[model samples]
Target: MKKLLILLLLPLSLFASLNIAVTYPYIGALTKEIGGEHVDVEVLAKGNWDPHFVVPRPSLITKVRNADALIMNGAQLEIGWLPPLIRRAGNNKVTPNASSFLNLAQHIELINKPNSVDRSGGDIHPDGNPHFHLNPANVITLAEVIKDFLTKLDASNSEIYNTNLLSFKEKWEKKLLEWQTKMESKKGLKVIQFHDNLAYFNKAYGLNNLATIEPLPGIPPSSKHTIELIKLIKEQKPCCILHDVYHSTKTAEFIQEKTGIKIILMPHDISALDSIEDLTSLFDYLTGAMQ
Candidate 1:
């Protein structure tokens, strides 16, 4: 009986899953999809919270400390909160220099890179816009990157990871066509945004971003700037204000009262809104927002 019990537990230990810590909900979703039963994901930030201002809680440090591998959005999106968690966690596996760590931003080409950096310009990402995941096409690229990373860490399950990635890419590519058709009519349409977080989305769909509600990146809206924006909206006659769920829509609402423009709430990631549950649904909500 003792020999039989030992044999039963041997297979379980041979196929133990990896614990992956991801910086945001979307990355967690992607890792889980590719990892399937081979891995467990721990998300650090809430999708509904401001990605730039996540609180570095003690719980997050513990998650990082226990993770077998770590993945982050990078491009300085988590610059304010992530580093501290990694430092306090004291997990060599989660550090940037470790082989168990992955930075998704390095794989994707970032847009809106500032020519120069300065504090006077409000918050600016030196490597261009950190919100590259907004583009649906980029999502596919990220899926591939995650697949490769997972395979490297667990080659024994490489076949399963490859199959999952292929299924994801096939489904995603079909949805891409559907989204393109849905957004084709809105191409070249002018719009306003509370912040330029949707830069990649706008570029992907050919939507023109006239201006941002905030005077500068990471800066709050001001009365003077609000007045100026109202004037621009009236003059430009943009379709609507694409507002992010995390930011206060007060400034956009005021502009609406002044100009009669519409405000559409755009969620940034999984759980950003109740309806956004996964990667597919996240893009579905985004592409269907205009309708």
Candidate 2:
């Protein structure tokens, strides 16, 4: 009896579940959906934290130190410090380059790939757009990639991952169809936004993308551009001028006053809004607001 008890305890200690770490809460939710009880999922960035300037706390290093895999959006979005964090964690099992690194952009159709990048002014991604997570369609595309990655990493639990994939796919597809129906009923739906962050949602919901408050991506709003943008918005008469949670509301307020278009606040990143702290809530609240 003593030998059997000791043997059982040894297995539990030696065969603990895999430690999986995701870069953001949204990704953590997805991992949990698939991983269920088989894997331990930890999110490095909270749902409300800025994904770019997140300082990896000492505890984060410890978490990553024990993880089996590390996942991130990774289209240079994390170029600032993730590489160093992975190194400091000193975990051979969770090294950014060697371990199971799931860079999500690999599966989606990338855009805004500049022929040449010279960031003389500010941050830029020459590799292509890294904001693939903004669109619901891209969500499906990336889901397939994630499922494959999980299966490859833990082949022993491939069936569980597949089961989660099937369930998630059905629910997401149903919601997509419902959202499309709601958007299709509206005619000539016009919108002006601070940034092109809504490109994916606009496409998914059939919302008209008239123009942006910001003249270009990465460029701040200038008085001259704002004047022109207000004029354009006045001419088009859009229903709202969408401003992301992180964007300066000064431009949005100016446009709203000059053009009388409604100011709509949105969360481009999952962490940016209260109701949209996770993927499902993000879509639900956004679609409801749009409708």
Candidate 3:
């Protein structure tokens, strides 16, 4: 009878995993990779939507409220939506200052910080670009940060997280080298984009972006700006228009109609397209899209 009782209790102990909530799909993927079997991750934002424009739905409040910890991309990427959810959830552990809260952006250096903070700049991030995860190197660094975070949060599972971290690093290092080689031939290639969403990606491969279809970040396309872009495309003869998934392709299609330039779809996150399932696959698709 005692042996039977112990066996029943064993299943309950095994289910004592930590519940982690993340603001983006990439963070959720990284947390799961490091947390292994010791955590249950709840992602608040859909991978298909704009990372900066996630809706803080009531359902997300439940996710945040129940989470034992929270991890976010931060750098004000969540400024538009996460705050309301956090406020409503009333989960102190997930608050900005809590030890249980991890902001991945603080650990990495961001690029393209605006010279001035104003609506005129079209929704610029004052702390710089928050899309650091698009860079493979930054992803590796974030992975280590997440591993350390999980280790500290659940010390009993530190070994598992550490082991997973080492394995992930090995695999990622190899893939990085492969991507570097793949992108080598495309260096110094000029491109255009609807937004500067691919800034990190462009920097990674030396893809020069002459201009964007949008007059400024987060602003809709204007006919006057489109005319200017059409003129620029004629003069610059850029390789292609790198358009993000969530945004409409109408402007880019119009540009292509005018200039005969190609428009390539660039996905910013996993599930931004049906084919992009995970971190490596996301980068793989981006690198492959260069052609």
Best by TM-score: 1
Error of 1 at 82 (Å): 0.4
lDDT per residue for candidate 1 within 233-277, as digits (tens), equals 999999999999999998898899999999999999999999999
TM-score of each model, paired residue for residue: 0.96, 0.86, 0.94
Which clashing pairs does model 2 show?
Answer: 47-271
Kindly list the per-residue Cα lDDT of model 2 for residues 208-291, writing each as its tens digit. 888877666566888888888878887878889777776568878877777778988877656678667578778777777776
Candidate 2: regions farther than 4 A off: 1-10, 13-15, 186-188, 269-271
lDDT of every model, 2 decimals: 0.93, 0.76, 0.91
Report how far residue 207 has shifted in candidate 2, in Å.
2.8
Off by over 4 Å in 1: 1-9
Query: Candidate 2 clash total?
Result: 1
Better of 2 and 3 by lDDT: 3
Give the residue spans of candidate 3 off by over 4 A: 1-14
lDDT, residue 56, candidate 1: 98
Which consecutive 10 residues in model 3 have the weakest lDDT in total? 117-126
